[model samples]
Target chain A: MRLAQLSERSGVSAATIKYYLREGLLPPGRQVNATTAEYDEEHLRRLRLVRAMIQVGRIPVATVREVLGHVDDDSLGRTIRVGAALWALPQVPEPDEDDAYVRAAHREADALLDTLGWENARQLTTISPAYRRLVVALAAFRRLGYDWDAELLVTRARLMHQAAVADLDFLETQPSEEEKVEAAVASAVLVEPMLQALHRLAQEEESARRYGFE
Target chain B: MRLAQLSERSGVSAATIKYYLREGLLPPGRQVNATTAEYDEEHLRRLRLVRAMIQVGRIPVATVREVLGHVDDDSLGRTIRVGAALWALPQVPEPDEDDAYVRAAHREADALLDTLGWENARQLTTISPAYRRLVVALAAFRRLGYDWDAELLVTRARLMHQAAVADLDFLETQPSEEEKVEAAVASAVLVEPMLQALHRLAQEEESARRYGFE
Candidate 1:
């Protein structure tokens, strides 16, 4: 099939098909003429797999390209390699933002730093960037005279990060490499909503219990 | 003190502070003269609270304004009203670009829907948008002839959501409202990382057991 046909079948635009081909996100088709190319069933399949990595895994194009190179090959070694590569990728931090809040966060962080003992203080940067953002918010909260202490926050944060690691390990289990990939993809994509839902459920249940309403 | 002193003390830049004032994210101060206004410790504290809400809670200004109207008011009824309002605000979703891979995922999702006996497949629209995004990716995986089905995915998702609720209830066993709020805020800000960590840990343990390598 031509690019147009592939686009129609896959629900992707022809221009995007070309872009994917050019970006090496998709393989080149068999050249049928100077201006035309022929794609096959495999191309359609590959297209879907690509979507899975990007949309579900939330991977960037460059990283997806590397993973695709390994996954499309489907050799045991390559699959292992792809998994290793996925592991090597740094855990993503939170969303991007302007420096206004970021700067304020840094300063307030210094005050919290003042309150910590050496054992607790060790390396403040050990927290993930996402957590760093939270620390900043907490710093602001501190200014409000809430009287929440730094030690408790740090300890809770460390415990939470540990728990998250545990969850990831649990979610990734599957009998086969294919299953691992499937679970991994699902884990990555479903995680944020799971967190949100969990927060609501936990808060509601806690509130009910505390208020003696339920 | 004046704006400059408050700005220095808060570490939030004067310009951003001005913006916060204009946006009503910060409360108004006593007008000292035609060109000056005097803000006190309460103003300083409120600025930090606003930062925490925006930067930590990731709540928008409008929502924050409504929440604040009730949150810090001395009246008990108002605080209760604000808490209720906070729960009712609509979640604003993070945006992502549509791409070829997303198209593939949608197709896989459609097939999964068929298999799962989900009669109102269109009900996906009412689910969290994240779930819809995942369906798109999962659809792409199906196109690759993977053995995964919708049953496992849905089951796991439901379970995880349930577990999160359970965790919140567990936290509510704390003795005081202050403790509850502290735990809730910490959980809200830190739970995602904790969940991610937990997923990783569980998957690792399961893999070790399945492979008999531990």
Candidate 2:
């Protein structure tokens, strides 16, 4: 196929595809002749993955390049190689160290990990956007005078971990490494808003029962 | 309390507080004199709620006012009024109707709710940001060539619903309507990124085990 077909098939514009090829986010297709290039199935597949990261995951192009590079690297184990893409995803700003609420929230986040017995996961905690987000949310709760109790936070996390396990099982069911990596990112970027939405719907259910609107 | 006192205690600058007052997001303080007005605890609480909606919830001021108005309306039952705020949150663009994939995804989303037995919650699904987000995500998966089996989507949604129930339980524990509404928005907006972060961390744990790194 050519650039025109790639754009038509992938739903990405020909010009944007050109930009990606120039930036090395997508490898160059085979040069058929002067002023013409041919793309293989691999190129088509790679184009889709790139679009997923940008469109669904909302990762920056620079970060997407790094993530794809990490995915392509063979030095690491297959799981770690693909998981590296996650480490490269954007992270949150560190909360102020001097703020007492932040300090307490940090301690609570650590303790919640301990309670969940996520020892190995904890090793990645310090580097994870998830951990920072939790700490930040906990602190924000306190700042707003709602002191999210430690017990409640832990309970919520346990449920989240269960969901994560289910997600991993589904990702493992994918047949290819490329698909697996795409699925992992897809699940992460896509399932997030879905979870939030389901939450609101569930809340509506709970609220109906509690207030007798059902 | 004076504006400075309110600022000092609330940690919002006086200028910002004045802006909130001028915007009618905050109720006017008691008029002690032409030079000074005294604010009560209610003003402080309302100010905090407004800030939560703006800074944490990222809701535009106009929308925030509408949400707060719904929250304050007495005719609606407690759960319905508070939950109304969620319906006002930002939603995703509706997927193209003529797209076969989108039409398929819409039916699947409907079935997902049916499978979960979320009968009452389904009423609010069309109006909810969560529903649109899920539909868009499901359609994207198809557009990208991932089938996202009906069983799998429903399974993922069940886990999400459980977590949501827990969230609603937590919200119910709050002591007042203002606090309840603020906590509802806080949980939705703040916990979202936290959930995404957790999913990534969980994937790490799963990858370690699957690849024999653990």
Candidate 3:
């Protein structure tokens, strides 16, 4: 298929396709002529994956390039490290806020993680910078009078990160690549609300169990 | 009494305070003279609240303004609507790559919520947008590939959200604001990890209990 056809098939614009090609994020298609380039099924597949990573994974272009490179290299060790690193970045705030808040949160999270004695903690180092930025910003709030010493908050963050690691570990154990990817995507999507909801429900159930005035 | 003094006391820069004032997000403090504005404790409280909405709750500036208006009105009914509206915005992705990826997973969570008959589910809405976003993103990925449908994902999300909600209700039954906030924060932080760990442990324990598998 030509560039136009590829764009139509893949739901990506021809401009973007060219940009990807220029950036070497996508390999050039077979040249039919000086004026034309022909693409194939692989290009379509690659485009979808790229979209997934950018639109769905929210990976930065630079990181996506590195990850795609790592995946292509097929180095199992590097793949694992890259994957773990990719998954370890802290969540971004909405906007117009300073980086300090996320830095503070990540710092608090790290301290909590340390307190929990989590092993192989270097897997999270990639996220430390962003987290530290948040923490610093949040420190301002603390100075302004919000409670920073809430042990429960610290414990909760530690536990949540620990749970994420465990879930990722389990997801990684899936034998099939397809299933692993599915589980990876699904786990990311499902875990937060699940956690939020579980806390709500569990507290209710536990409360009722413990203190219901029957 | 001046911008510098306010900045020092608030830990918010003069630039930001100026932005807030211009946007009407922050009310003008008492003007002491032609060159000086005197901010008081109320400005500090409002500023902290604004930071909380942005940093903690992840609300945007425009919505934050609306919410503050409602807060000032003290019309609980209108405030609830404002809260709900504010909750509907997407959780901004963190700068960290991993956090962004996790957030992207939430695309699927919307479908899962619908599949689980959880559309307009009140309790889930009350918690963090980050949680909700993650659930939906995961659902989107599942929809794109694999046999995993929204039904399964929704069930998990609902089960989790319900747990958290029940816990909230339980905490609310108590009299102390401290306990309530502690419970809310605890639920926010620990619920995900707890559920993830509990599920993993339960699966392992169940297998062992029933089939002699470790």
Candidate 4:
């Protein structure tokens, strides 16, 4: 198929496709002649993935490239690949003041995982700097007068863990290596919005139930 | 107290507080003399809230202003105030192609809520445009070859609804109208990062448990 058909089938404009090609987001199609190129099913698959990352996942092109690079590398383990995808996400900056509050939060995060018997919780910070930033952010919640201690964080983590288990169960069934990697990356990137939307919906329902807002 | 005291108490810099005053994110303090101004506890509280919205919540300054505007309006109902806060966050753009795929996802979102017996589920879109964008995003999941339908969505929503109930339980105790509004807005804005971080931590733990990677 030519670039035209790829654009038509993918619903991406030809010019944008060319832009992707130029940016190395999309691999160059096979040279058919001086002015034409052929794209195959692989290109179509890659195009869809790229579009999903940018358009749906809202990831920047550079981050998308980095994430895809990790996915394309077979030598990297699956865990590392997942970490890479997650690392590409925007993260909250850690508080500049390493105050007692920040240190307490870190301890609480570790202790929460310890109490839950989650053996790998402490290792999370080492995997991604975002995890440490997350801990700091959680501590900042206390400053807002919300008593979001380790107990509350763990309870919420446990619930979301169940959902993650369900999501990963589906990922385990993908037949191809490439499919599995793409699924993992998509799960990491896409599930955040899905869960957040669900969170807001739940908040609305809860608010109505509590406040009698019809 | 004055601007320096307000900064000292809130841990925000004088320059940033001045910027907030300039941006109208914080109200101007009362005039004390020709060159000095007096700020009270209200100023301190507003400064902290604005800092939380920008630094921790990662909300854009414009949206923060809009959300604070709604909060400042005493006549608005609690539901509307909550909606305003939800609206202020960054949202995913809805899929442009209103194809069968997009429509199917919408039906799936509705069906998921229906099956869950959640009465206020449809009201989510009315509350926040993010919900509609979320539905379209779920459709894009299928494009990535993940079989996420209404069933999976509801299951996740149910889990998060439980968490939301837990979060809102604390709001019941605030005695003053201002406290309630600030708590509601804080919950709506700050909880996303907290939940997202928990999600990531849970994912890491789950991945390690399944893959045996330390």
Candidate 5:
């Protein structure tokens, strides 16, 4: 296929696709002539992945390059390839440990991770941003006078475990390696706001249910 | 309580608490002497709220003022007070209408809202930030070649509905109005990271289970 066909098929603009090529986000096509290059299904697949990372995931161009580097590195196992990309995404700045609440949270987080036997998951490469974020969030809750006991935290984790497995089940159905990786990345990034929106909407629905607004 | 006492009790420094007083994030304390002021439980409560907004929720000072203004207003009903703050939280920039994918997302979002009977929730004062986020995310997913059909979206919503209701039940257990409001805000803000972290951890666990890593 030609560039125009790829652009039309992908619903991305020609100039944008050209820019991606220049930026190495998308690989150059087979050179058929001086001004024209031929693209194949593989190029199309990669272009879609690039588009997902940039437009949907909102990953910085440089970060996308780094994440894609992880995706393309075959020396890593499949789980690490996916997990490493997730690990490489942006993270929150470390919270100040001067506060007692934050210090307590670290202890509580260690207990919770121990309860779940997730210590390996925490140190998979460096520490998972999720663990750091969890600790920060737990401390914040404690500071706000609403302590989330380990029982509550574990319950929430179990609920999310099912949702995550359900989502991964969907990704496993993708037909190609690139497609699976693209789907996993896109699902992880794109599904977040959807989940958040659902929570808010559900809250609204519940409020209405309780207050006769429905 | 004096400034020093307030600092000791809240774990917020006297200097920072004074800054909040000057910035109107906290109300003025009673001047008990030429060089000292007397704070009360109200001040302590407000201090916790302000700290939660800044430290845990990461709300900007100006936005916290706006949200707190809504919270302090007696004219608005409780639902709108909380709902309005949720509505006022930041939003994703509107997607490009020139792209067919985004246009399709707008249509799909509308259809999903209709399916859920949430049009009123979308326009509570103005379009809810969550609603706007949902649309942007939907467009992004469509661009990534994953159309979230209405059935799937509804299923996700039901799951979140249960979780939101459970959290609200905890909020209802608070014994005072201000504390209830503070806990509501903090839970809504702080719990998101916990939920997100849980999702990621769950994903890790599921991957381990499937691939024999656990």
Candidate 6:
């Protein structure tokens, strides 16, 4: 298919597609002649994935490019590939290390992970900023006199893990490593808003039940 | 306490606290004299809350001001106040209204809510943009041929609702409406990173278990 057909089929503007090509977010189509190129099914698939990453996942283009590089590279280990994809998603910035609260929060996080007996807890260091921020947030909640229970956090993690396992089961079935990587990354990044929306809805329900807020 | 003491106690820089004051995110301190003011514990508390909203919650200053306005206003209904706080939290941008996919996703969202028998589902329209974006993201997942089950979503929601209930239980005990609003908003915003971090950690655990990775 030509660029116009690809644009028509994918519902992406030709100019945006051209921009993606220029940014190397979408690989260039086969050169047919001067000022013309042919896009195949692969290009269409990639275009859709790119759209999902940008439009739904809200991943930055540079991060998407890096993530896609991992997706296309076969030599990288699966753990690193998956980690790269997860890292591409947005997260909270880490607090300054010198801050007393941040230091305490990191200790709290380590203790919580230890108490939960999560294997390879130190792998959290890879996403340390987000993890550290979580700890800081939890500590802030505690200072406000809220009980952010360690047990409760573990329970929530377990439930989310169950949901993820189902998603990963499907992901594991993709026909190729590349497809699997794409699907896994897409699932990790795009599914977040769904989870968040459901959480808000659930909060509404809980609020109604607790406060008679109908 | 003076501004310096408030800054020292809160661990926020005096300049930033002054900025918050200038921005009206923090209420002005009591005027003592020209170029002099006195802040009390209320000011200190508000300063901490403002910092939490900005640093940990990642809420924009404008939204923080708006949310704090809701917090300070005594005449606003509880539901509206809580809604404002929730609204102040970051959310995904809604998809285009005219897009067929987004329309379908909205329909899907409505149906899912109906199936769950959630009360006052129409209130979703107030925050429809974020909700619609979530539905659109879910639809994108389905388009990718992943079975993102409604039942699965509900289960996740139930689990999250449980976590929320635990948090809200603490919120319910606040002695004043202002305190309740502050706690509710802080929990709504700051807890998100904690949840996301735990989700990622859970993903790591699940990945390790399923794929036999370290």
Indicate which candidate wins on DockQ: 2
- Report the C-alpha lDDT of model 4 over A55-94, residue by residue, as the tens digit: 7767788888888787788777776777666676656565
Model 3: docking quality category:
incorrect
DockQ, computed on Cα atoms, for candidate 4: 0.50
Per-residue lDDT tens digits for candidate 1, residues A1-214, read: 9888998887767887788899998889999899999999778866766665665556788876766564544454422433444443346454234655455555545554444332222232443333354544443455444554444444433334344444445545555655455345434444444444433433343344334321
Off by over 4 Å in 5: A94-103, A114-126, A143-148, B94-103, B113-126, B148-150
Predictions in order: lDDT: 0.52, 0.75, 0.51, 0.75, 0.75, 0.71
**Backbone clashes in model 2, listed as residue pairs:** A130-B197, A197-B130
* Model 3 vs. true fold: TM: 0.57
* Stronger candidate by TM-score (3 vs 5): 5
- 2 or 5, which is superior by lDDT? 2
Write out fnat for all predictions, comma-separated.
0.11, 0.54, 0.12, 0.57, 0.57, 0.37
The sequence of per-residue lDDT tens digits that candidate 3 reaches over residues B66-177 is 6556445433332233233334334444323345433544444444445555434433443645444454555434433333434544444444544545445555664654
- Model 1 chain A poorest 10 in a row by lDDT: A116-125
Question: Candidate 2, residues A1-214: lDDT per residue as tens digits?
Answer: 9999988888789999999999898999899999999998778778777777788878899998888888777677766766677667776778887999899888877888788787766777666666777788777767766556678666666667777778778877888867677677656666676676666667777677677561
Evaluated on chain B only, what are the TM-scores of all the candidate structures, in order? 0.45, 0.88, 0.47, 0.88, 0.87, 0.86
TM-score for each of the candidates? 0.53, 0.90, 0.57, 0.84, 0.88, 0.84
Which is the winner by TM-score between candidate 1 and candidate 3? 3
Worst lDDT window (10 residues) for model 5 chain A? A119-128
Output the worst ten-in-a-row residue range by lDDT, candidate 2 chain B.
B205-214
lDDT of 3 at A103: 56
Candidate 5 per-residue lDDT, tens place, B3-43, comes to: 99999988889899989988998989899889988999888
Task: List, residue by residue over A28-146, the lDDT tens digit for candidate 3.
Answer: 99998898888987677667666666665666777667756644543344334334433342343332334565555556546654665542342434443323333444454455555
Best by TM-score: 2
DockQ of each: 0.17, 0.54, 0.14, 0.50, 0.50, 0.38
Give the CA lDDT, 0 to 100, for residue B108 in model 4.
Answer: 75
